[model samples]
Target chain A: MAVDEVKLLGFWGSPFALRVEWALRLKGIEYEYVEEDLSNKSLMLLQYNPWYKKVPVLVHNGKPIVESLVIIEYIDETWKNHPLLPEDPFERATSRFWAKFVDDKFVPLIIKMSSSTREQKDKVAEEAREILKTLESCLNLNKPFYGGKIIGFMDIAVAWIGIWAPMLEKIIDVKLLNEEYMPLLNTWFSDVLEVLVIKECVPPLDELLAHYKDYYDRFMATKA
Target chain B: MAVDEVKLLGFWGSPFALRVEWALRLKGIEYEYVEEDLSNKSLMLLQYNPWYKKVPVLVHNGKPIVESLVIIEYIDETWKNHPLLPEDPFERATSRFWAKFVDDKFVPLIIKMSSSTREQKDKVAEEAREILKTLESCLNLNKPFYGGKIIGFMDIAVAWIGIWAPMLEKIIDVKLLNEEYMPLLNTWFSDVLEVLVIKECVPPLDELLAHYKDYYDRFMATKA
Candidate 1:
């Protein structure tokens, strides 16, 4: 049976959740959004995601799909308009490879940098810069975004960087990317953030900073 | 231009390499396999996969696609035969979620157990059993393989568990999955091993054991 209704379970400030929101909006699919507090996860969130209990679970026709990337792929395949991924098989695979890179290297580094003290944050500065440098190499000075003129799967997958990095830099006092460090990537992030869809998903900067500040403090305290 | 030729650079015992091999053979696609000696990677491999500089680089026509899962997806889409993933987008997403689980939890736990001291090996036994138990629950008292009746993507993704787990058990002296702990999963592993395509990709057990034993020794030495 074709699914009739669509719904999403998410937290407002979560980059993972934002990916789904942006994909759905770009596809122009209308759906209800349920915000979950990570501290006190609701029954629906727990029921939808029994294993990970994480947000960004999409419920289509009452069936729940988990994991942000998996959810993003689901949205792309289900909605034909505004195709997030490329049509070519090899191109699709290349985009997925970069998506995996975002998950494996980029997101974890952001989390680690966010949760570290000033000294500890300094320790990962070069490693973080190297990741951006790799991204710059992909840009090739002519391509505007990861998708070569379009906001692509990898671009949306990385959209969090534009929104979250500024907050992280503010709290950690570590400059991650700039014209000096990664010229192309710095411009790419700027380009991504300027998009209407991308800008709409980003929580207000002041609210985000206040939330991450407390989150970082709690995270580091537990680690200590 | 359409991709005219396919080539693979691989090392014999790597599960990652075996994934590409099984996917190609299952699709009944003809390709040249270049065996790599890990001690000295070929210039082609270095050029094809300069990022990771690792084996299991699939050169379709001339372009290189790295990463095991991404390469498998590319092969499935490009060939259009014996589809590795399900047709339904949600089902495809579900299989990928488990594939991520295998990479994130299953492989790491196996590596940790393989290189652990006797005491540490004993400590991870219960944890390892728990992971298998969760997999067993996914079976829900039915389903021969992760892809239902077929030896599909997840089955290929996890073929290593069937082959390598037994070898790890013998060397580490820790039973990961068996009739007692995860009966359905143990049987599924056995059945997957019996697949001709899967069996052909696996290195001989004695050779694998010897290779892994040395690998474990070197891994522990570095940690010590």
Candidate 2:
């Protein structure tokens, strides 16, 4: 049998790229990671993901898979040892539903917050809080993670909220995941951050904060 | 074992609902279809899917699954007779990628065209055509369907385009999925419409067209 050749093309600051990284690490898969310069992307990145031409492209045995969530699903299917999605079909469907919700609804609001202007910031934060509240309702304080007991697919899908939401809150001076409003989500965040695999893959807090701050400043400067 | 109980909550005009109906029919699964009144939704619809409170919701043996694509997946996984998604892991990933593309990118533009102002109609049509062109490039003339010979997941996800795009074109006095610009996609649309199960599930053309025309008139009246 041929050796499994796995490669991930990613950008350091992107939460989406980090998702693929966390999934790989949680599965204890060995692979090469290539950091792409977003300003001037590598030809390989372009060739691998022509549709999006974006990061978190996974190459396995010379076949390229794009879309972060799709890549994660492929990984879970290929590797049986550490199952990311649930065994039962209905549970798997529920997992995919929330994961899509996070991607389609939650993440976009967070991204909107990052680029929002002085006038737009408060409105965006208010909207983010509303979404956070919806997410809060779904989580159980008794369950340590979205996967109930283990750090599973939903954990990886949503881990960025714990890391990036705080960074945005600090930069914009608005609260999103307030303990008063979203206690379960706040606890979930704290617990997810403590997972060793997740912690190992997260960019250092200080570095991530600085990066976000710089990004916000540059974006605001252009607007001004 | 007890007999399996399956139910689908759907709205007749919805392409998303039709996708679920097509999947169940293709798999030869017996299901009770409940038509949802979007204006005043049923209690069961609300209870089953409080998150969106929208169709199509698939209930199998007392468990409800929301999101059209996710529901289709659940159906495919539970019933083993006919496989909607390919067996190869990479092919499955590719199928998912295109399905997401159709949902995320393509569907929105078509929906936009529906409510677009007289002024916004041309630009939205232009944008829809641009997306259609990209979809065109991915399709091969040699293959009869998005899944090559068989109508599969991608086919179901995109079936709405063949049905709704032309309706929008007729209503708006603009053309999308034009034969000259997107030959393969146009051909693919023609071939998919001929499929037996798909033919069975599609809403009657006259009724669907009248519904869309009425919808467009009401929307325009509100704007005016």
Candidate 3:
């Protein structure tokens, strides 16, 4: 196991950081987790990710790899158990495409929803509705996860949506991803949360809310 | 041959579009190139890619794949000859990471460098120099390409730099990426242009400069 010593530098409340943690756990890969204070990053974090200056940098045998999804792919390939991606090239492409779509489309919109004032939340809801509908189409009611029955790459890529979106909706007082607008995606939110692996990784909601509230206060103070 | 029919819907002026063209030619895959007018999009283009409505949509056996790099990866996997990616997992991950860094960091900085007015161009040059320096560090003086000896995914991903950056320097009158600042990167640029597969795919300099001039005029008019 000495040859397999993996180290992950992460932050507690960040969704991107959580992704690496979940991937490591899913693959049964043992990694030493170093919690980073993003306000003042560690020397190792800086050395690992000089460009992004962000969390979720995976260090394996003194080599540090940045980018969360890239880290997941590396982890999946490095460890042969519980495959995250598909064997077929097209299927793998599809998973990567949607995972990218989720990052590009939904992540920013969710941020916009969370960071807006209560008055602006209502106006942002329309754009949020359209994004959710597009995401909704990617899922299948017959299949439990995005990559079919097993927890595959796309499922792990968006596992944060289920845990985080509900809190954002509650905080902003806007209904962006509820069942009426996006039935299948809404169902996915519920289903992915119930998966034992995902459930364990998501920190408690109250704790998350407290963290986000502090963020919201900081954002509001800046606006004022 | 019938089942393998691949069609690329693209705009000649776009570097992103050129990437797919180069990959297809390299792999010896036959594909029909449909020139798209971005201002007045075709119905098929709209139908195939409703969200981005962008070029370089690769249609293989009827399904349309969007996103330039994603399409290139799909093509490489599907065709398999003259492989764009390495078979090793770590090497593959490194290729993906740098490809993404090019897109996220270098591409936008290049755009900023290209689009700025003469007065602002001087200020932007400092930033451009930093980006080029970081990119330079990735190369090896001993190797022709990023992966060495052969043309690869990183070479294709960044081949635009060789073709476009020189024209941009001439147009903007800014010398951000010269041999002094980046000897290895400057050499990489020269080496990439010499490859026959790349030579055939890149549009002529005069045509590209004219296209960029028109873009520059449009950009100025909007700012005015």
Candidate 4:
């Protein structure tokens, strides 16, 4: 049976949710957006995602798909318009590589930074530097986005990292995206922000900052 | 230019390397296999995989694709003969979810079992149980493989993990995949092993155990 109704369950503050929303919008697919409060998730959200119970679950014709990357791929394949991946086999694989790389490296780096002691944070900082170096090399190829000409799968998959990188610097007091350390990454970030779709999809900077501040305050209070 | 040559550079003991071999065989794509000695990797392997400089790098018509999951996708797209992924978008995403899950969870479990201190072994064991439990629950869909009937991408992506799981239990003097703990997983293991491509590509158990023992010995010595 061909699925007609597409729905998204997401938290407004979540970059993962934003990525799915952007992909759906770009594909010209109309989807009902159900905002999820992460602190107190809806019964529907829990039912849809019993395992992870994470937001950014896409329900298409009543079938729920979880994991932001996997959801994005589902959206792309299901909707033919505004292709998210390249038609070329090698190019698609390249994009998937970067997507997996960001998921594997960047998210964990941020988590480590958030939870680790002062000494461990230093080691994580070094690890983050190495990951950024790899991205810088990929950028050196002169590709405007990770997809070469347009924002493709890799860009969306790592979109959360791009959004969080600047905010993390504020909390950790480490200038990570500066031109001095990561010139290419800085350029890439600027290019990504200039995209109309990405700009629209991203939550306002003020709201994101407020959310982070609240979390940091709570985390520190617990530690005390 | 439609370049038809497919070459896989691999180390014998690596499950990642075996994934490509099984995928290629499943697709019935005849290709050249170059076994790389991990201690002394060939220049071609290094040139092909400068990023991680790791084994199981697939060079298709001179372009290198590192990472096993990425390589499997490339193989599927390149060869149109036998499809590793299902035609349905949701089903495809489901397969990929399990693949990513196994990739994220199984790799750490194997590494921990192979080299973690005795004090840390129990913690790792507990973590493995949790992940395997998730897998078992997902397996309730009544599928022989991760997909309904035929072995799909998730099966091939995780085929290597099942091979390593038994071996790791031997190393730790524990039964990780016992029928008592996970009867579904035990049945799934039997089903996955029944596939001809997986059956043929798996190296002899003694060979893999010998290789792992040597690697573990050296790893422990370095830690000492």
lDDT of 1: 0.84
CAPRI tier of model 4? high
Categorize the docking of model 3. medium
lDDT of 2 at B166: 88
| lDDT string, candidate 3, B1-224, tens digits | 45677899999999999998999988888889999988899999999888788898999888889888889889888888888987777788888988898788877777776667777787777776787788778887788788678998988998797787788787778877778768888888888888988887778889999889788778878988
lDDT of 4 by residue, A1-224 (tens): 76589899999888889889888877878889999888898999999988788989999888999999899889889888778898999989988888778777777888788777778777887888788778777764666887668787877777666778888888866545667877778778788877897787788887898899789778867987
Q: What DockQ does each candidate score versus the true complex, computed on alpha carbons?
A: 0.88, 0.90, 0.71, 0.84
Tell me which of candidates 1 and 4 scores higher on TM-score.
1
Q: For model 2, what is the C-alpha lDDT against the true structure?
A: 0.88
lDDT digits (tens) for residues B45-87 of candidate 1: 8998877889799999888999999999999899987989988
TM-scores, one per candidate: 0.93, 0.94, 0.95, 0.89
**Model 3 chain B — which ten-residue stretch has the worst lDDT?**
B108-117
Global lDDT of each model? 0.84, 0.88, 0.84, 0.82
Q: Which sections of candidate 3 miss by over 4 Å? A: A114-120, B1-3, B114-120
Question: What order do candidates take by lDDT, descending?
Answer: 2, 1, 3, 4
Mark the regions of model 2 whose C-alpha exceeds 4 Å error after superposition.
Answer: A115-120, A140-142, B115-120, B140-142
Candidate 1 per-residue lDDT, tens place, A49-101, comes to 88789999999988899989999899898888888898899889988988888
**Model 3 chain A: lowest-lDDT 10 consecutive positions:** A172-181
Q: Locate the minimum summed-lDDT window of 10 residues in model 1 chain B.
A: B135-144
